[model samples]
Target chain A: MTFLNRFAGLRLYAVLFVIFIYGPVLLLPLFSLDTGLYPTFPLKGLTLQHYAEMAANTSMIEALKNSLTVAVIVSALSTTVSIPAALALSRYRLPGAAAVLGFMSLPLLIPSIVIAVALLIILLKFLGVALSLWTVGAGHVLICIPFCMSVLMSRLEGFDPSLEEASRDLGCTGWQTFWRLTLPLAMPGVISSLLMGFVVSFDEFVIAFFLSGTQTTLPIFLFSQLRFPDKLPGVLALGSLILAGSAVLVVLAELLRRRGAKSANPGDI
Target chain B: MAGYGLLSPALLIMVAMLALPIAALVLLSFWRQSGYTLDTTLTGANYARIFGLSDSPTVWMGIPFYLAYPVPVILLIKSLMMSLTATVTVIPLAYPMAYFIAFRVRSGKSIWILLLTIPFWTSYLLRVFAWKIMLGYTGAINSGLMALGIIHHPLDALLYNSGAVTVVLAHSWVSFAVLPIYVSLEKIDRSLLEAASDLGDTRWQRFRRITLPLSMPGVIAAALMVFIPTVGDYVTPTLIGGSGGSMVGNLIQDLFMKRNNAPMGAAVAIVMMAVIALIALLFVWLTGYHKMRARRR
Candidate 1:
């Protein structure tokens, strides 16, 4: 009945919401451990056969390699691009910063499918550019920019601007100040942006699906495997592995960001 | 000058990757594609087919009549409907989670937010694919029921329907929906709620009068956030959506990749984007989110 405590039902809803978000994804790992080919109930005993098979699958390994390469490139490129933009936004009163920021976040609002198709058109039809890992990486970078910018912006904004100014007043050049003070302070966000960008590109399917040629990413390979019932268990194994790896990386990134924020503005994080 | 210098690289990339490419796609939509070569001539024929420029139409709900090639238009409508359904379901379910974390959680709100963010940063493909496993023919739901002697046959209705697509979208996007709403709720001044309570207002009355209106920006943002992206989603509809569940994304994919009709595909993509933009702008105008900032200024 109290204003602060009328959420007895809400507490229960929160628990169920967490379950709803995680329960389906957890099913992949649960079924991966089962011996049954189908992801059904009533376990047919536990087995690690699918993991072994996934390890031995040469095609899947090649796709995983390609995905890793693209993800690495995407993470580096997107983060590198975002650092300056985030710095500019955080430090300066740029003209129309809000509108420019909104414009940049356009990729987040538009469908990845539309991005994919449009890129496919431009690359193949207009630019005469071939569909390769480069195009896929480009798509990933566009999608990753808004996220990476926010991460770096938060980190840069949290720290006192006085530090950078102090470095500047000490006769350090702008680039020197950025290198010696700004970049170091924003390191946590830089790393977080890199990891998140990597996970996004690695698991991205639609953009790569539309933009790729002979080269395929792990997700594209997994999607292709979905057609065969025999590959179901292995697909589940791969999916579960991706899910787990992403969770670990994201949690680590979030913790690092929080730690950076806590140190920058003690007590808020 | 320094700010612009620093920002130019990111702005350039967006122009190269987004603006230029989309413009090309838009131009290509006007040009005809016959075989491998694109005819340099611009034409409205592509747009014409979508809006029933020729032939008698199959009318639905006494509106959205299409006489020729109604597939793209129909799928666009279907995808929008499914996305709205998902958005509606998510707001109600997510509002309470957001509300709980905002109003109830005292010390560890960051932990709860982190929990929500973790799923969001994970593979969207894997999350949706997981739903396919749970909702498939011999999926967990049916298998569990059969195991418990509750059913003689696996239920086919659980998957391969618009309902399946809607449910998956709701689950996958609930995390994103929660954080914004949570932030908005957390930002509310406690004094206002206290003010209401002191006036002998009920908790529900306080929420309805103060909390709901204050959080409208987040709710509207959350709705557009989920609805816009999911409307053009390709993976969910294709992987599990059977015939009945295919959205505009699937149709676009088919036109370009399978059918090799890139111009037609471009037209469909443009149409989908236009409709989404209209709806988004209208929603913001209706809710006055866009004007609220300027009004405050």
Candidate 2:
């Protein structure tokens, strides 16, 4: 009886915590479907008008395109850069490697707001470069490196170095062995890194806020809209779509990560 | 040689993207500039202005102090407090969930983990905005409460306050806290728990002495991970804090964007970084020292 009681209590607490975490996100879809301008309860009737209007907004569409373009470019660039870094760091020993890795990962610790402000001052003042989409892409690459490195490193670590060695011994060049063995083995990590990097760049706000000139990303567009409260229902509708998309991407990323881990070491799980 | 060549791109990118910007921030902090004009002569006036060392103490200290001081500090402190509260709230809840998943639940650990991570998929801003809609004056919570006859008047305090920000941000970040602690709990040797049971230790006694200490590292990491970023965050405060909930990040934002006072902004940003670094270093050092002392004992 006591055990059952305790289990019930535990389940209750867990459900409440889950509600706290996920309740607001769940509320967005409900409110988006709401008929009124204000996000009030007592739904007058369900309507898709807000979503349709959002779809038809030209500037919002442009912002979405800009965000997508930047995210894709940044993800591709960062993954390409992280691959060799991950490979060398995981596969071989080098001088100051720890320090290099630490430096590379330090951006994760520093607040993005600080980085954004710092970059703005530096890029405009010292380099005399005007803010542009390219600068925003550059900032995304900076922030995305640590995530790419960590994911790639985990994949690299689980891989057996002996496979590459065996391939090399079997009359294959180092380059050829890496292409055939390492690259194939690490593809899952590469894919996860690419997905995660894309999502992060797309969703990132502070960096894009500072670096984007004349071109507004979706997040910045959403932020600008928040000042006007009446437009909030429209924002909620837009937010619901973004939330659904991001959730799908995150799940895909996680699956890729698990797949990478599993393939790198078939014995572990 | 190929490996070195392969590594160069990332290194070069980091140098250009990160290191150069940081160097530029330092330079910009030392210069006196108005709008687009760059003064060739360097000065410490910005730092002086921030520190209230100038003759125009109002610009240096009074105005920003009055207008900007309370919001960011309060928001940072409130967020930190809320994170601590959430951490405490989560420990008891997560300890059992982790326990159930690790030792009790017979199958589908990966599914639960996936379920936990689902919330992270949505854009962070969108999630926060969702909370705004849910907690607003005419929002879901009050409507539900009023429908339930919990109160005649709607709870005006439900949104745009420190409490709302704290609750929502804590919800958003709970997964980060839970996952680390779960990993640590799973690592505990089952035999140790069984031995404690065999030795006739009460369940509570066994948990207090065995499970708790073993999981301290994860708890610490979880707390630090959530606490550090929450302290620096401005988004939650800006969205939910209304006029009262601005954080240090907001001040930095105003300095950069609204005010265009680069030096003052840089000074505030530097100070914010220094404060976080100091706190993080202190936490690590204290934890390390405690571990060493416990080892000696």
Candidate 3:
């Protein structure tokens, strides 16, 4: 009887904890649809005015374009860089490999704001590079590379190197073997890394705030809009859109990760 | 050899993109610059100012009103304290959730994980703003309390304070803490727990002797994941910290954007890097030591 009581108690606690975790996020869409300006209860009827206003806003469109452009470029570039790094770390017997991996992961440890400030000073003063979309893209690439490496490294670890060796022994060039055999096997990792990179760059605020000039990203534009209390509803509407988009991307990434893990672990079948 | 060739682009990009910027930050800290003039002339003035070591050489010295300022050091220490407090609070709450998901629950694990991660999809700024609504005067909690005749007036003490910032940030980062600890907990073998129970061990004894020690790696990882980012965060403090909860990152932001003193900003940035690096190294060392001890026993 006591065991059954304790089991019921545990289930109740779990349900409440999950509610606490997701309660506010689910409230965002509710408040966005709310006619009331403030997020208080006692529903003041539903309205689509905020969503319509968001569509008519030109600056929001431009910022969305900028964010999309940066996210795409950063995702492609970071993936290209990480593939080789992940391949080398996983397959090669290089000296100081652990240290190299550790060094690559340092950006994850340091704060993004510090990196942004440091790069802002260094790039402008020393490199004579003007701040633009290119600079913001570069910062995103740095932040995304570690994530790319980890995802790709995990995928590569479970791969059997003998396949590549067999291809090499059969008169296939290294490049050919990599492009044909290895790349196909690692495709899922590549896809996940690309999606993860895009979502992170799209949602990143600190680096874009410091490095962007004339071409502000979506998050920065939303932040500026938040200062006017009257614009809160429209802001909430836009935030809901971003939330939906990110949820889709996260789901896609998880799907790709699972596919990659399943392929790597054939015993699961 | 071709794998090395494939690796060169990434390694080179990392060196140029990451290492160079950090090196420049450290180098710029020692140089004196004024207005638009950035020069290579090195001095200890920046560090002295940060540490409050420089003495004024004015002839009209010995004024009782003059005292060295310790704002930088004080902010750095305070930020560390705040981040540590957040980390400490997050762990106990996270461990239970992670344990429940991994060991106790068998059904709907994916849905639970998905629900846990849903909060991260929203704009981080908007989520923080939501707290302002919930905690503000005449807000949900206060208004609801008054409507129920629980309190006569709205609670003015709920918003724009350290307590508010801590709670909001804790809510924001709960998923981050939970996921890592969940991964580690999931890796624990079931037979080990069963073996403990078979040997006449109490539930608490099994948890302490087996589960906790094995999960230390996840605890350490979660601590670094939470503590490091929280230390350098200025946005939470800026939005919810109001007056009393400003951190070192806020000081860095002020120096860079508001003050327009790039040199001083660089100096503060370098100091922050040093402090954070030291803390990260300490965390890694401690985790390594614990792992070694666990392996021995």
Candidate 4:
């Protein structure tokens, strides 16, 4: 009944929970290093051949380039557009803001597969738009916006609005007030929004899978590669690297957000 | 008006990409497809086939049944069943972690949350694919067992079934379940617990009365998060859930990609959305969650 033993059980459960989440993920690097192709547990001599093989693969490299290109553009585009809307939602007394937010967040509720199919129908059947990297990039932007908006919205809402009001009162034009006061204040959110958008667009698979015609994003490529058993090792090597990359990006974003939160309002964090 | 102006760019993008595309999907569903050329005729035949119009026995034995085109209905039920199982599993597992963070963790609260969710932001494809490596015939589990001299043959039964799909799904949504429940648990007033204890409420009693009810919103939110996504998930099932494990997602993919039936795929997609929304609403109603939210607002 005491505090110590009561939480001791919970602590143990927490440890097990971490293993459950990370266990499968960690298997990637472990197997990627294994000389054997299968991800079986028995220790095989370590090898870097898969990574080498991955480096040599032209299609894999192309997919990586395509994914990176899409992610960068998507991050910038989603964040840039989200700044105004996010600010509007957080700061303004706009009518139907809830409905706007609801509509944006609808993609989160509906299955990504369903969304992909919907977009596919639009591009191919209605618009007569040939499926290409352009369509994939468009899909990425759609999925990234809701996520980026939420990140920026939280950051915008987190700080004092009095500063913006004061700037406006001091005869600063609306645009000047936003540029001079609001944008800098919401810098952390903007950065976080960009990072969020990047991470989402980078790891995105379903939408790209449906929208892409001749070109393949890395995830779509990885998914197609999943069919071949021999392709698994290179897949593992690539998967491990991606997992590490995204993990780093996410941690960096978190650290920046925390630091930014502190700077935004002294002692608030 | 300025606010509207500020919002216009993001709003326009969503409308052009998300809203218009979905509207187009609905419109496409009403049209017929034949050999790469879409027939522009507006017809309800797709819906009819989906609802058993083409089939002679629309009402088999008492309830509406699809004698023909049974795959969508069957897979829809199965997908819902698996998602429900995964959602139910997620709550118990996620609640403890959320609770530990809410009540037990003294410092580094954000770090703990960050640690748990980092995996979520990573490649969902890789994460789902990991299960194939873990549970496949020559995957980690069977091979590990063999190395330990626990079993001789690799268990083919471990991979590619509803069982595999359910487990992967439950694992896949771990972060989504935890964060919301943690927020709800964190928001519980410390004073309420103390007041309940002063009134002779035991720890368990206090939790049952106050903590549980208050946290129901988060729990319900977690359930909806897990249930809704898993129902429409295509990756996990496709990777690990072979023929026996194929859900509505796979069928929709098949219809669109392989079967050359885009209109039918649209129909199935619409139907899936309708069913998912209906079930989610029903659950929220049953839990009185909407009333709770309105009252809170």
lDDT (Cα) of model 4:
0.89
List lDDT for all candidates, in order.
Answer: 0.88, 0.78, 0.81, 0.89
Interface RMSD of each: 1.0, 1.9, 2.1, 0.8
Q: Order the candidates by DockQ, highest first.
A: 4, 1, 2, 3
Instruction: Give TM per candidate.
Output: 0.96, 0.89, 0.91, 0.96
Error of 2 at B191 (Å): 2.0
List the candidate 3 regions with Cα displacement exceeding 4 Å: A264-269, B53-67, B107-111, B117-122, B143-149, B283-297
Across B7-112, the per-residue lDDT of candidate 1 in tens digits comes to 9999999999999989998998898877877787989888987876445767765774546777887788889999999999989888988989998998999998
Off by over 4 Å in 2: A263-269, B1-5, B33-96, B289-297
Docking band of candidate 1: high
Each prediction's DockQ against the real complex: 0.85, 0.60, 0.55, 0.87
* Per-residue lDDT over B213-265 for candidate 4, one digit per residue giving the tens place of the 0 to 100 score: 99999999999999998999999999989998989999999999999999999
What are the per-candidate TM-scores when only chain A is compared?
A: 0.95, 0.94, 0.94, 0.95
For candidate 1, the per-residue lDDT at A186 reads 84
For A50-113, candidate 2 gives per-residue lDDT tens digits of: 9998899898999999999999999999999999999988887887787989899878777888
DockQ of 3: 0.55
Runs in model 1 deviating more than 4 A are: A1-7, A264-269, B53-55, B59-66, B294-297
